[model samples]
Target chain A: MQAKKLKYKEYLEKYKNCPTSDFIEVERDAFRWTGTDVSLEDFIPVNIKRKPPARILDDSDKMCMAYGLSMFDTLNNALKKYFKLYKKQRIHQQEHFKQDKGTKIAMINLTKNDGIADLPNKNNFGHFTFHEYKETNLVGKISDLYSVFKSNGDFNI
Target chain B: METLIFNSERKLKTENFARIGDLSYFEGPLLSLFEDLTNGNFYFFDWVDRDQDYNRWIIYRVLPKHLLNFLNRKISHLDLFRQRPEKSVYFTDIDFENKGYFYYSAYEIESFPKNYFPNEDSYFDPEDCNSIDRIKSIIFNSFARQKSENEYSKVYHIHNLKTKTNYCNQPIGRRSKRTTSVNKLFKAIKFEDLKNSPSFDYYSKEIKLYPDLRNPVQANIKEDENKYS
Candidate 1:
């Protein structure tokens, strides 16, 4: 039998060295308590719970996103449903931002005294600083409903 | 009882999950054949006597598949339906990813006789006609009587998803007098209040005699266990 040499590209192309996959990053506002997104991945609803500070002067305060910390009891139970689906990976995360320019997600915190009117300062890259709110009738808010995901990071529930 | 056909569609927009169950709704040779296979298992009740029942048969199962399809090997739709039965039917798969939802489909066809269907006026029994919650009480009184003296692990779970209440408790084996008495102590309201009411039928023949049991062996009912739930 005559031996014929095979092209190097043919062997290399056929024998692919598989590369490791990357984690599927999930971004949520975490403020609206979007339990369904967490649920879609089999995490329990109780896990994504939120426990706002003793006195949240408005809806924006209770609505800030959570990064798997300080979840309410019921919310945590619901979050476990997702953690179970994703197997052992922690998928809960949020992008730290200062004002209205930040993407709307599941759990978001809005404790700014001036609201959107006080935004546009690019250097507001720290935690929220709430002074006494002089506005009246601006109470807190929370609801249980389906969330709609539009863009890569923007979410509403 | 009637033949509950699978709608064979996936993306069901309905708010409920339709499951396949008992075949006893259909009667005659077809039902008898299935009963022979399962050895008289109650779940095999099928299209033997269509004239017998009507109400429960009218409503059908929700499709787990969006649309049932097949290559037109033959001209007729029914032939294609039976040949490619699985494709003509669908099961819960892929789309559920990211959504924490699960699907339930029963292997048996429903055997609820049309005659067994409840009448608005009479309920199932004549005596308790005035009870306001007769419909509620009747459905709650369902039971999974032991197919055989030795057969365990058989359960009949009935829930009124509409009311969001699961009225029936499981494992309907014969209880000792002592066990019955103990259960009576803690129950806030007695089960008798619901059990004695009409509307619910325990899948029993009003005229037939009981199955012979003293001889220590698995009975005929447990053998042919392919009835709808």
Candidate 2:
């Protein structure tokens, strides 16, 4: 009559075997954000330039290095969750939280055509991930896929 | 045991110099040359996979500074050792293994010429009496290859040398791995090609030069209050 608590291994197995389709839906929105320290040129996918922090995911054996996004139904809900997680992580790391400057958030539309995949991770429930197999393929595709905007103002591109 | 004796004999035969625990010693211009080579540019490529587990390679474009850092612990990264890809080198990092043991392949782009010397003002030359033998002596004397994974292959281990105690906890063995990806990268890029390659410009171009005077999140809250009031 009581619910079972999942162990770490069981949790890993549950997510690993979880049906991919359950996590991602076509035409659903995914949100990703960059810190205020990042600039616009960081979004450029040139081989010589450093990638934007939002676009560069943590390296892991379980998953290929790719852009990490949180799937949410609305922009407001996504922003609230993003800030909450950001604050929690900063506090966990014993780092001081700095004032949000001109931070940028990108909203990406997931479609069957984009070749994106759902990788339900324990770190975040709504994690949607994608990666380009080749470096050259990423050069022009990044800017085209996501609609970016300033978090504070009406400025967007 | 036998390997250590052989190495000591080789050093003595070549350089006529032998020290008990000290690995190698250089003097004058040769010291500067050694410093330049050890601290120079290098490309590091590493990845982890379900099947392969962990793999890494250090490809020396000039010489390997990473190895020197590993030896001396000049820079410490707490638990993780991460090197991001730039114009010059590939990206790599190790998160799981905090055991203070590293296994990665290391390769020199191309072998230096037998006749090569640092400069015309050098004391010894191949054309002179103390020629190719002296230069070869320096190379062999400096890093003694103790254990060989293969009969023909050379494996240089610096475990016996006195190393500084640091956060990463002094990794013991720096062994080499033989993999197809390492060979491919070695063949694809050449030492001459990297001469004109773009240097790292991440700090200059990507980082914000100035912090914002006002917090955007706070300003957003104020805007919402104004609209409601």
Candidate 3:
């Protein structure tokens, strides 16, 4: 087993200080390293310039003018709601993954073996099958599967 | 636009100004501000005009409500743009300690006449003077309303970024260094240096940028549907 320590502190700082553009780069890197194939659009919407969505509140208070609310208050409220929604979504995803424990454990075990030929059978893995593994490298795929299985515990095989 | 037009009547082309295109891309990133606000952290914003290397520091207080409507529907996530009167429409720049800072209020800036002293305007033109006076009233009344609604509001705590000796709010140091966050905002921008460029830089704090909304996938259906209906 690889003793992989997540760069929580580094990534957290990047998340905090990096603007959406540079943040997307970091995001892409993180996804690549973690075997997350999420489209960049899914995480952050882009503009006409194909630039990532994120803005700096300037001295003009442009945001306040457009929306007719204090930039401070609007951002304050929006952020609270966004985080609340984000937290709720995360929990919902976690709960969903938990419900399919049998499938998850089987997938994790099957993924531990290398190559499509090595995978046991379709009945054991269900929808998260060999096709899903193609997008990620064998090592990253196994690590992702292992993390999920490890965090939630191995289900009855 | 307000930053450049300081008591000037000359026509300023879009080329004269640096634009910070659609700021809606920032809504997601600036969400972090909410956490900072709740934790009692006072915020001060700095605007840097990349072309001229100019900087404006802003410190502001939250606005007082003009009229509290109990029956009004609470704003939904997608319905952020629905306008309402008596809301906090601008940020007033205040001089806390004898320091003069250009405070840009959104409403005041928006109210500025599209043409200050149009060529058509002559001292003999009484109608033009009335139009100008109307513009003044709009700017004045906003300030007047703020003054009248004093007791209902609170002063925002401001942090001075400049040294006490340095009064003029200007760009810091030579060759402006981009902060990590600022750099990220511009990551995907492809710049072409054109002496006579046809496209002027478009500036807005809330325009949804990136992924080019023109693409079919990025088109916001709700906004389009509502507009057509």
Candidate 4:
């Protein structure tokens, strides 16, 4: 398990400096209710316990350990791919699970900068998917990432 | 004027709860269950979809402090069900025949209106009002028509005092009639109006069942029998 984990870390290290473009985090309607105002609380990692509440999607620890912010290259792509999967999941819920009416999808546009690019690697779908290492200061890492985007005014609807 | 002494207190057990997703909005069947339970009132919500052969219901009870903290965002959604103060919320899902699941949860209110003793009168009797058998009975009766006549049928029902809508399946021969009735009902009702209605009363005096988690089966055996029946 240790060797396998290191492999993932080595894979992430390879793309630490890769250049990337703006990506979108498909958000829930609950997060976007405030309209254009950027709530840093929304960006807080699920592992950390403070604040206005972490995103529910982050609860899936299997996806990405640190803070999995699943994103896509563009809003349309996210809608076409991610949201399509989400809608199908909703239908499945209607058939065999509890349907949550509030699971509506929305999007947030974020600019890729030095701070974000340094985090880890991007997937083929244009997501800056990263995992946390043992030595990483998770709270500080997330706060710094949020600051980089907030100060640069890179948050957009 | 009568002084009501709030004397009774009930706390939830630590190991009986389960966490779901966040509570985004403050209103819904789940939230309503929490509020009613917090105020010492009994409440339940149930639904069925014959097409999927699925059915579900939830009964709730809660502590006032926890509810207040939850509403104030003092308790993050992640920690909503975490054990605290030697007690935490309780939740369990008991499955039944025919793809049915009954969910029950509670953290008894800290106190009740002075001189008010909680009993069956606090809410309607569960056996008569909200029970797995009651829901099953509805489904059985609705589908019996199709089984006897050799026709296709579908049934769905969502029972809640707030929504006040009951939809049941009809035989294929009555499909058009059912569709017309459902369409008419949809056109007559406005979702905006339902959203605007006052659904909760924080100071409500009604008291609900204080579940004995240690012996849930003994406390509510009829509902528990769904495991076998």
Interface RMSD values for the candidates, listed in order?
A: 28.3, 21.9, 21.0, 19.5
Q: lDDT by residue for model 3 over A15-97, one digit each (tens)?
A: 33322221110110011111133222221111111221112333232222111101111222323322232222223323322
Index of the highest-DockQ prediction: 3
| lDDT of candidate 1 at residue B138, scale 0 to 100 | 22
**Where does model 1 sit among the CAPRI classes?**
incorrect
Give the 10-residue window scoring lowest on summed lDDT in candidate 1 chain B.
B25-34
If chain B of candidate 4 is superposed on the true chain B, what is its TM-score?
0.22
Comparing 2 and 4 on lDDT, the stronger one: 4
- In the range B18-89, model 3's lDDT, one tens digit per residue, is 122211122211111110111111121212111112222222121112111110224221122122222222
Q: Deviation in angstroms for A153 in model 2?
A: 13
Which of the two candidates, 1 or 2, achieves a greater lDDT against the reference? 2
Task: Give the per-residue lDDT digits (tens) of candidate 1, residues A1-157.
Answer: 4332211223223323311122111222222223332332221111122211111111211221111122222333224322221221111111111111122123333333312211111221111211112341112323343333345634322
Query: Residue by residue across B1-229, what tens digits does model 1's lDDT show?
Result: 2344344443322112111122111000111101111212211111112211111112222111111121111222223223331222221211111121112222222333333221222111211112224322221222222333221112111112112133224223422222324223212233344345342234322102123222222232332121211
Worst 10 residues of 1 chain A by lDDT: A92-101
Per-model TM-score on C-alpha atoms: 0.16, 0.24, 0.21, 0.22
As a TM-score, model 3 comes out at 0.21
Best-performing candidate as measured by TM-score: 2
Ranking by DockQ: 3, 4, 2, 1
lDDT of the structure predicted as candidate 2: 0.26
- Which of candidates 3 and 4 reaches a greater DockQ? 3
For each candidate in the order shown, give its overall lDDT on alpha carbons.
0.22, 0.26, 0.22, 0.27
Per-residue lDDT tens digits of candidate 2, residues B122-167?
2211111112333334334324321222211110011111121231
